[model samples]
Target: MRLPLPALLCCTAASLLLLLLRWRRRRGLWKKVRAARQRQERSLVQMEMAVQRFREQHPSVNVTSILNLPLPELTEKLRDGSLPLEHVFYAYVGKALQMATETNCITEYLQESETQVQKAKPAGKLGLLYGVPVSLKDSIDCQGHDTTLGFIKNINKPVAEDSVVVQVLRRQGAIPFVKTNIPQSLISYDCNNLIFGQTFNPLLYTRSPGGSTGGEGALIGGGGSILGFGTDLGGSLRFPAAFCGICALKPTGNRLSKKGVVSGIRGQKAVAAAVGPLAKDVESLALSMRALLCEDMFSLDSSVPPLPFNEEVYSSTKPLRIGYYETDFFTMPSPAMRRAIRETKQLLEDAGHTLVPFELMNMDYTLFNFCVKGVFADGCASFLGNFKGELEESSLGLFWLMKSPNWLKNVLSWITKPFMPRLSAMLLSVRANTVDEVWSLHHEIEEFSQQFVAQWKKLNLDVMLCPMLGPALGIGYPAKLSVAVSYTMLYNALDFPAGVVPVTMVTDEDEEELKGYQGYYRDYWDRTMAKAFHGSVGLPVAVQCVALPWQEELCLRFMKEVETLVLKNNRLI
Candidate 1:
């Protein structure tokens, strides 16, 4: 088949051109496949490692010994010098290390924490939270620890200075032993990442701990550590506390220092995030808040108002009126949660306090506007920027737009109509609004805030009691519908002082009742909620106590009263 030299050269050239194009196409496809497979492999390895670590970390540790000793008892031991700072530090550090191994709750453990114990002063000079081991979410800066916030690329970067809270905690002699887990971008409710992996509920390994403060919740909730720090803009603290049955507060924005805290959305001032604590009990949460509020944080950052912890607010002895609601404006709470709210109201009323029913103004509009737009207004680019690898499935629920195909996503409004009616309607409602629209929403938020204050004044209430949301949700359920957290996020928008206190535990009866549920709306939200509420039996149920802004002391006092009433009435305390 020998041919002329010119024809042979032409055929060889054509063959080479085709080979080059094919090689480029194959390379691109392989890269995509490799990325997808790597993501899955990493997730599986993380999950397996978490399980293995849990088994190895606490082989002989007495979980009961740690649980039996409450914070007050620990404090007494520390005060009398019976328990050295090292003893307290070791006990919690040991437990936290164990919990972190099992649950993957830690992003960074301070290997040099013993140095903190060795340098601790005697009891006379120690402040309120002295010798206590407090963990911070990875997002908050602590000197000498990398505030990775769960990004692998951030692992090598160490923080140069401590955040304001870290400095305050150190001044009080609290050992910052570990940096707890958080979501990849701190945007989703679920806590999972490629770097530190997923943070599971210590109570139930399969379930979420809640985030962006989920690690704080898991560590404290599991009794691995007590009196930990967490931040909340939209229920980041409250949601995890509620899910794990721990107590927490989301103080009014700017009331707590936001400086030196690392976040994906650094300059998002529209809905400000406030740093606070997650603790084992109500007293712990109060004490932690008081400690942070000592001398006021405004000095460190002038943006914060120079208001000290208003002492007068806590002096009221009156059995004040309280408003109770089972659900927020957006979603009706699960039956067990509603039951918890009703039970709490009955307990309070029986204790000689007035109980009234109240509804948040345009709860639906407020929730849709503030949460969807205000939080993700930057189009999640900021959040996605932190990820050098593939997105975790737990986070996809938050940034839903990322996975959608362009043509289908573009014409979603049209496709939504009559196709998947229930979901269709929700998509139309939840579609992100324009920046100008978000600005208007922000103004409306201010108006809503004023109206909320007016409503509180009209009620003349000391504290309003409500459910934190449904009972302890099923494991992995938070990934399904985190939007339900609006119940807690609503207060954050109002910048009110709200505390979550565990009131009851979900029971068989609650599950049986939930099965017979019937709501007027047959929307997708309703059906999805119904399914999610099914397996959430036998978990803790908690109530949220809310008061006016800067009234944290008053809110805690009222919370104790309600706690006392519930305990005395049920004889559970």
Candidate 2:
């Protein structure tokens, strides 16, 4: 095998060149990356062109004041002839497109928005929403737009009908303006996919706007859309709301119709995604909830309950017995999150609302046994299968557990036990394989729900103050700390009506505290979490409000109270 030095060098150089060529070839193909890029470019171009055409056809008007005006005031002005539907529609359309440019937040702007605005009745003739423009999360079906949910395979196929929520919005005279971006299948909190690239936080380009409704979060946060409707299976709505410094409500599942929504695998009802609103303010969210839980929605979707908004519960001046928890114990509360909670808890107490200490025990167990298993009963084959013959976004790296064998997970769980007990425990938590195991998982979730309800009743809690995920983790960190969803995912599992209200911003001290964070387990998860909040200063911190099943109005009332208290005052306490 011996060869001259010059001959060996020539052979090695030839091999190196061959390897480089092969690498470049793979990158060139990129598993449909080129097609996805072209699609995104076309979508954005169409949006810009539509906005430009609308501007050309309609006379220009100052929408600054209209944009600043809250939902209630805007609607009132429209009804009183002080504001025109044309101006409001254009204001949102232009701003949404602009925000999309800055943040990559929107998926596709609706072409029929102009038509919707033109046909709209004048001055309160239509409905409660009267000419208000609304943005929808990408998963909510729009008749002519493709709800890709970040999959290339799902592209170019427009829906045949409007999602029930969209129909409800139209019936209320609300124009669905645009469909926002989302992470493909919500494998991570940060929104990114091959189809639409990534959605950066409008507040800070480097930070992530939580998802899968994150596009709505960034768009609304950037003042593009004042009110938007989104869904939450596992904090999809709340995460974005918190990250983007906005308000949102995740109503109990089945409260709003999900008939036409394009979400998880068909017929997989492990954990139902509830549709609700993300708004500039809590009152707007209340209004949205009121509008959605109306007869229009009830009549349109037979699957939903025939329950209208209970004005009495929402408007009641009575004090509430509130339960609160500063930490979920699974993920250590960030300094900003802790402060938001304590301050809100203080404000609630000062407002004569009782704040009882409520602890969320066994979150890791709950997260795995209930949420993860329930959502991925089939070991996530249905989810992973979607990515077949497709380019996968990097955010899905952590979501590859199902691809691994049971023996491997068991071996990893056993191997990592000593050093990373939390990780080991998670690995040890197996997914449902057979139908019998699936039924058992369902029974377990029911039992857990019953137990949670029992505890809520035992505490006599009218509402609860919760620590929300916030201060916008750096990009890619949310996925790394996926289990850190302890705060919001708990509600999703319990099917409670949870809402996020921005209370305060991260301060210098909060940053210091964040730097000093040590996870409860003191494992990699803890250290990674500390590292995750590296650049969290000045970002908005929010507190979550949770209410019992079907008590959305009361939840809104509680959210409004927290928002009011936070805005009112809380001097050196």
Candidate 3:
């Protein structure tokens, strides 16, 4: 029954030819990816040069003094005509261009911003954020600019109108000058994409600024922009703020409009994405929230509740009950992170605020089953679908996970369960094949949220203080150590208002102490953490402050308390 040798040889040749054709096709696609990236990079370079020319033409503008004033003070100055709109705008543009050139943090909009500045000068103090230069995360829509979200497939696809958030900010006299970069899928914590390349931390080029709000982290952290906006689904806002040594508030969903923001999974709402501020300090964050939550935002998007920032709650003089935790049940925080929580707890206790011990029961299952699972529902098809032709380096790990067949994943989970329970549990939680399954998961999320709220009520805590995962992770660490975000994701799962304030810096002593530390599971993630944090000395360490839903003002107030205490004690670097 065997075929003749000549016939078999002919069949083998045909197979080889098919393989060659496929390889050539892939090579062609890769060439297109490269060309697209080159175009984006060239635009960035030209924008940088233009900014330089503008700066040289206006040498009298003192960006240093303008940047010195926080967002609130700067707004006051603008309203009183003490700070010229052009001067402030160009100062930031100049600084932002310099930072973007160095860190690759900015995507585009320098030219548009220059035009907006000219327009703002005539309008004069129209509203709260008058004359303020606001930076936007790339996912936000700006008319005439591409809301790429770092995908090559999305490159050059210009949005026709401003997002609701952008419209609201513009009405308040805020000029959206430049857009910052983000990770490819806007899902990973490390900020890099094929289109925008990688955004390096201004502090250390080897480390990541954190994401999906990483560009804001680098730009604002480097003092390029005073106030910026970033959307947080998991730890997007707070993680970058912590990594970059800035402050940010991940407000409850619906607090700000998410109408025109581009997301991989547009309608997935189990752990809803929220638009929030990433800024230099707590005051700037509070001011941004006030401006973003105005009547304009509510009218533009009726889904956004008509709730202005509550100044009274933020300025309360009453004593507070603060609950603090050193570890989420799933992982042990690094020494620097642990110290941040412990030190913040000590400072709060000294300030006459009562500190209560708090713990979330079943954090591991809750995070994986509820938060992480919800995000990856549909097996990450929507996320992967965005990759039209090529894949991003940041998404490789996720791609592997998403592309694997369920039967294979189940088999591997069973094989690993005996030795690696955590990995197995993670694998077991990646459900979402049907509407009924997603519905059941959504119901579970609601139940978990209700239970957690009940626990918070019983504790009677004004706010909770906990460790932000670790100091800024090294570049590419997000791929392997994705679960490290569980600390912040827990808040997202509960839909609580959370903020991160810089408390201290990673020190040699902290690094040395962390070497001997063993986490709750002493697994792959802990090993990866030790490696990632080894050379992270002098990187910022921060703590997470959480409050009940719709209590963003209170969250900012507590964050301000931490920032003040840290500054007073000379804890911040």
Candidate 4:
């Protein structure tokens, strides 16, 4: 087994060379690690300094401290010279800029914040949300500002005219400073676009602020802005507000004009979309709604209803009868959302409101067969229009269907469905309408709406309470896993006025209990729901308060009652 002397010498030289190379590699790696550590330290120091400067520059004023203060009080302060419009505007603008930079919440800035303040100052009076800094979802247009809608190609192309809603807000003395982030194609529930990147939840940097209204949710939730305007066709407004612990109302169709907002499916109006306000409190939402409704929007858009906000409708002495449900029968809500519903029910009942158990049997099939996939039958062509050039990593989910060989998409919809039974049934049941199918789906949707209305009439309930989503999912998971719009979509299908209101926070118990979930939809949705729940510790759990069409006042009244009861019981305010 002994080697020759030459062989031994060669082996010795090779071992020495190897040791030298190893040493050099180790030294280089160490240097990189040290440099990374230094960079991270510097970043931390910069963040702390920025936060400190923010605190010093904008010391908490009595007015700013009252986050839940009614809009009327805030407006009164601005009008009486107790609160300077400039100071309020600057303070919020500063906060939003700081938060947006730190959290990447804002998609595009008008950068004319100072000019906006100057313009509002000479008025020397309050209109409604006087000097209240507002943020809009990127899909909304602000004249001369890019409504990229989160596509990189549209970055420099500014909108020629203001969106009708933006015009209304501007007239009401609200200073719109920035356009917030949105999802690619404005399709998914995850808010990352090629142009502006992802928006993080204000409560947890690691979790998502739901999309496509996610940016507005993140900014407003982080206390960067007092008011936000977002549009919802599916669960865009409700999901973001629920995820970020803000309040929002998706009003009935034609109540608020959607004249100038951009959309993925521009003319695919099978499910109507409404533009609405998102705020820290319900009163702020109402204030914005009232201001927008005041302008007689019916004149501008013949589709808009002339129904003005009625103050008297919400002022009821008698207790309201409310219906509440924990699970949607499509899938059970996560423990936290379930707990929120139970607690909210208890609080309302304690407040002398009658709480009824409401059930829409097989609600998933109703929502699916009618509203969602059927509406997009001619396909998501309009939605898929802006995917030219390089696609962002985030936009990958939307193309999952297209990525499959057309045969696989077709085959999977048929064959692989039985294994993942519930979702398979859902996916298979989704008949992307041909020209003929589109009319049929629309007819089906109408029929479903009629059935739902009949059931609501039978219930005789003022409002129905349900989870905002099934659970508080982690950041990037909704779109990544693709199973978010359950609770909110049902409302869209029915075209009901549904509002999201936060009630409680997720608990350790909630997380622990989800470990044993055994449900029928036991495929992507089940696994995704579990993964989504994993990182969402202590996030707010919210519920949707839904009412009949044109019953927005009743919906608000019910929401106010629920909010009052919850806040008083929890001592949140």
Best by lDDT: 3
Question: C-alpha displacement of 216 in model 3, angstroms?
Answer: 1.1
Candidate 1 lDDT tens digits, 1-573:
898999999999999999998788656545644553354345335534543454475466444564557777776678678765655565676577678767878766665566777777674566777888888888999887677665555655778999988888888777887778888668767787765667888877766787789999999988888888888877788878878888888888777787878875676656667888888777777777767776635667787777766556665677888887777646777777888888888887777889988876656566656655566555544555566443333354535754344344447747866655434433444444577876887797788889887887798876788778755455555666756767777877778888888878778888888887654355655667787667666677788888888778888888777667767777754
| RMSD for each of the candidates | 6.1, 4.7, 2.6, 9.3
Q: What are the models' TM-scores? A: 0.84, 0.91, 0.93, 0.86
Cα error, residue 143 of model 3, in Å, equals 0.9
Which parts of model 3 have CA positions greater than 4 angstroms off?
1-39, 45-49, 122-125, 391-398, 571-573
Q: In candidate 2, which residue pairs clash?
A: none
- Model 1's number of clashes is 2
Q: Rank the candidates by lDDT, best first.
A: 3, 2, 4, 1
Q: Which stretches of candidate 2 lie over 4 Å from their true place?
A: 1-60, 430-432, 570-573
Q: Return the top candidate by TM-score.
A: 3
**Tens-digit lDDT track for model 4 on 1-573?**
999999999999999999998788656645544553353344334434544554576576543554444566877777777777766665666577667766777755565655777666645445776777788898898897767666655655778898888887887777787778888777777788654567888888878888889899889988888889988888889888988998999999678878789876678757877788898888878888777887546666777878888888876757887887788766657878778888888888877888888777876676656655654555445555566543343363446564334345567777766576554544544434467777877787888788877877787877788777734467667765554576777777778899999988877898898887654467666776777787566788888898999888888788888787888877754
- lDDT for model 1 comes to 0.72
Candidate 1 stretches greater than 4 Å from native: 1-67, 388-394, 402-410, 414-435, 518-520
Number of clashing residue pairs in every model?
2, 0, 0, 2
Tens-digit per-residue lDDT, 145-169, candidate 3 = 8887777667667888999999998
Q: After superposition, which runs of candidate 4 have C-alpha atoms over 4 Å from their true positions?
A: 1-70, 121-126, 393-398, 402-408, 429-432
lDDT of each: 0.72, 0.83, 0.84, 0.74
lDDT-superior candidate, 1 or 4:
4
RMSD of 1: 6.1
Measured on C-alpha atoms, candidate 2 has an lDDT of: 0.83
TM-score of model 1 vs. true structure: 0.84
